[model samples]
Target chain A: MSLHAGQHPSTTAAPDATTGTRDWLIASAAAIVALIALYAVFFDNGSLIAATGSYLHEFAHDGRHLFGAPCH
Target chain B: MSIPVLPLLGRGLTAGGAAGLTAGLFSLLLAEPLMDRAIRLEEARSHEHADSGAAAVQHHEELFSRSTQHFGLVVTSLVFGLALGVLFAIGYALVHRRDPEAAPWPRALLFSGAAFLAVSLLPALRYPANPPGVGDGATVAERQGLWLAAVVIGVLGMVLVWQVYVRLAGRSAPVRQLAAAGTAVAVLAVLFALPGNPDEVPVAATLLWDFRVLSIASHALLWAVFGVVFGALGLRALGRTAAPAPSGAVPAG
Candidate 1:
C-alpha cells in the first residue's frame, strides 16, 4: 500500500460546497465576535457601552492598561 | 487529517478560559499593586495642579470603587481571553486547511506565539504601556488610533510573511527560512515608519519602566499559558480523531 494512501481515512473524502460554506460562516462569525470583544476591552472609551454608563470602560480599565491598550 | 471546525473552536474556548484565568490571577497579585500606586500618583498630580490654579480638576466620584474595579479586571481578562481563543480557533482552522499534515501541537503553539508577537509585543514596542498618570488626557484618542494602527500593521505583516514562507516550500529549507526572514525584516522596516505616541512620559523613569515591565510580563504569561493549553488540548483532540497509521507510514518522532 502507498504511504499516503488511507493516511487520513476519516477526512479522505473531498470537502463539498456545503462544508466550505459552513466553514466560511463559522470563521466569519468568530471574527465578528472577536472584533466586538477587542473593541470592548481595548478601544472602548465610554462609547460602546455608554448606556451602562462608564461601567464597561471602568471594568476593563486595568485590563486595558495591562494588555497595553491605549488608556488614560 | 481535516478536523471539524466546531470541535477545534470548543477546545480554543476552553483553553482560552484557562489561560485567561491564569493571567487574571497573575495580574491580581502582581500588577494590581503597581496600578494602585499609579492611580494615587495621578490623583496627587491632579490635586497639585488644582492647588496651583493651573487647571480646573473635576473630582468626579468613581461610579465603582477601586475594589470593584479590581474584581472587574479578572472578568475583563477572562472575556478578552475568550475572544482571543475564538480568533485562535479560526486562525488554526484556516491554516490547517492549507497544511493538514503539520502536527497540531507545534502549530497551535507557533500560532499563539505569532499572535503574541503581532498583537502584544510589536504594539507595545511601538507604543509602550503607560500608567494612569503618564499620558495626556487630551491626546488619548490620538494615541489609541496610533496603537491600533500599529497592531493592524503588525498583523498584516505577519500574514504577509506567512504567505511568503508558504510559497517558498518547494525551495530548500534554508532558502525558505531566509526568504521568510527577509520578508519579516522588510515588514519590520515598514512598522518602524509608523508615527510615535503623541504623549510624553512625564512620570519618573523608574515607575514608568517598572509598570511597563510588569504589564508586559502579565501579557507574556497570558500568551504563554494560552499556547501551552491550546496545544495540549488540540493534540488530545487530534489524537482522538486520528486514524491508525499504516505500517512504515508513521513518521518517527
Candidate 2:
C-alpha cells in the first residue's frame, strides 16, 4: 500500500484494540513466528531436503491425487 | 556414470525452488493482504480533516503499492531462498571443504543478509514503495508484521526459540531462560534426527505450549523491523522535512 517514506508496516503495526492482554500476547506471538519464518525461508535446513522428498513423491506419484485435493 | 551428481543437483534445485515458491505464495495469501489493509487504513486516515475523496484515492494508491509489493516479496523469496542455500554450499565447499552447518549463527545470518538485499531494496520491489505504508497506529502493525516475517522465514528456530524469548521476557529469570533455551535446542535436535517434513510438527501442537508461534505468519514483520532500524540509521543519511510528501509528487527531501 502507498505509505510515507518513514512509515512502513513494521513501523506502523497496531494492536487489535480490544481490551485485554490479547494484544500483548498476539504481538508477542507474531514476533516469535516471524523470526522462525525468516529462518526457514533463508536458512539451509534438512527440511528442504524433506520437502524435496514430499515434492517429488507428490509430483511423481501423487500429483494427480494431491492436485485435486488442494482445490477441493 | 557420467552425470551421477546431476540428478542429485537437479533434485536439490527443484526442491529449493518449490520451497521458495510455496513460501512466497503463502506470504501473498496470508501476509501481503494484511499489510495491504494496514496501508489503506493508514493512508485513508492520514489527513487532519480530509474528505472521503482523499481517503479513496489514498486507498487506491495503497492497493497499487500492495499488489506490487506482494509479488515482489514472492519473487524475492524465491531468489533469496534458493541463493541463500547455494551461496553457503559453495562457500563451505571452498573454505572448510564441506557444508557449514557447524556455524549456526553464520548460517542464519548469511542468508538473512541475502533477504536484506533483495527484499529490502526499493527498486527490486515491484511496489511503488520498497517498504509498505505506515498509517495511524501503523507502527504497531509494522512491528508485529516485520517480526512475524522473521519468524516465518526462520521457521523452526522461531517456534523453538520464541518460547524462550517470551518466557524470558515475562519471567526475567536467567536460569529458567537458559533451561528453556536448552530444551528448545534439544527438541530441535530430535526433530532434525527424525528427518523430513518442515511443517510436519503442527505449530498448533507446539502452541499447546504457546499460542503465538508461527514462523512465517506475517510478511511485514521482518520488513517493519528493518524499517525501524533503517529509518533511525537513515535519518542522518537524509535531511528532515516536517511535512509528508504532497500528493501527485515525490518527496523532494
Candidate 3:
C-alpha cells in the first residue's frame, strides 16, 4: 500500500510528519530497551541482578560465554 | 508502506524469540558438553597447583547446579532473542520506510545479514568467546569494556556504510559497490586500531579453538533463524495488507 493512500487529503502533510516523528520515537524506545536487555543477558555479572544473589549470573553464564560476552 | 509500529514490533519479538530458542537448544546440545569439560579441566589445573603448594585448595560452590544452569541457558537465550527481535523490527521499519519498493523478504534478509556482520561476526574476530575457566577474573571488566567498544564501533561502521550506500543512489551499481567496500575496509581499520583483549587463553589450543568456533556457530544460527523467520512473517504481512481497502476507508489505526 502507498504510504499516503488512506490519509484525508487536507491532513495528509500533517499526518506524514507526525508518523515520521512517531516512528523515530518508537525506534528510540526500542533501542534503549534492547540495550538494557543486552546488558542483562550479555554483561551482567551479579552487579545489576544482585538481588537474585548471582542466580542470574550463573544462569546466563553459559550464554555469556556462548555469545562472546566478556566473562571470567 | 508506513507499516504500523505495533505489528512490526510484534513480528520482531516473535522471530527473535524463535531464533533464540533454536540457538539456546543448539548450545545446550553441543556447547554444554564442551563447557563441562572446560570447567573440569579448570578444576584439575587448580588442584594440581594446590597439591604442589602449601596453601589448601578452596572449593567455590555453585549456587545453581548444572541442570538448573542448563535450564537457565534456554531461558536466557529466549530473553536475548526477544530483545534482538525488537531491534530487528525497528530496523525493518526503517528499511521499509526508506525503500518501500523492495520486496519485504529481501529487505528483511539484507538487514538481518548486515546486523549479523556488524554485531556478531566482527566483534568475535577481535575478542573471541572463551569458555569457563579460560579468562582471568581480574581482567573481565576491562575486557567487557573493550568488547562493548568494538560493538559500538561495528554498529557505527554499519551506519556509515548504509549512509554512503544510500547517498550514492544514482551512481553506477559497481561504483556504489566499491564505495561500500571501501567504507568496510575503513571500518575494519578502525576496529583493528582498538586495543586487543587483555587476558590470554589459559586452556589448550584445541579446546579454546573448539569453544570459540562453537560460540560463533551459535550466534550464526541465531541470526540465520531470525532473518528467515522475520522475512517470512514480513511476506505474510505484506500479502495480508496488499488487498485494496474500501474506498476512502480510514487506515487501520
Best by TM-score: 1
DockQ (C-alpha based) per candidate is: 0.51, 0.02, 0.47
TM-score, candidate 3, is 0.86
lDDT of 3 by residue, B1-253 (tens): 3445656787789899999999999999999999889988888888888889856433334888888878888888888899989887776666565433236576667777888989899999988899888676778889888999998888889989988887998999999989989999999999999898887677989988999999989989998999898878867765565544323322111
lDDT of 2 at B196: 24
Model 3 misplaced stretches (Cα beyond 4 Å): A1-30, B1-3, B54-61, B99-102, B243-253
Model 3 scores a C-alpha lDDT of 0.79
- Against the native chain B, each candidate's TM-score is 0.89, 0.35, 0.90
lDDT string, candidate 2, B90-169, tens digits = 32222322221123233333333433333332111211111123212223233333433433333444344545654566
lDDT at position A26, candidate 2: 39
lDDT of 1 by residue, B1-253 (tens): 3346766687789888988888899998988898888888778878888899889554434877888878878988898888888887887776676544346667777888899998888888888888766666578799888888888888998888888887887899999899999988888888778888887776878888888898788778888999898888766655665655332322211
Model 1 clash pairs are: none
User: How many clashing residue pairs appear in each of the predictions shown?
Assistant: 0, 55, 0
2 or 3: which has the higher lDDT?
A: 3
Per-model TM values vs. the true structure: 0.88, 0.30, 0.86
Q: Tell me the TM-score for chain B of model 3.
A: 0.90
**CAPRI-style docking class of model 2 based on DockQ:** incorrect
Clashing pairs in 3: none
lDDT of 1 at A38: 84
**Stretches of candidate 1 above 4 Å error?**
A1-8, A11-16, B1-3, B56-61, B99-102, B172-174, B243-253
- Minimal lDDT window, size 10, model 3 chain B: B244-253
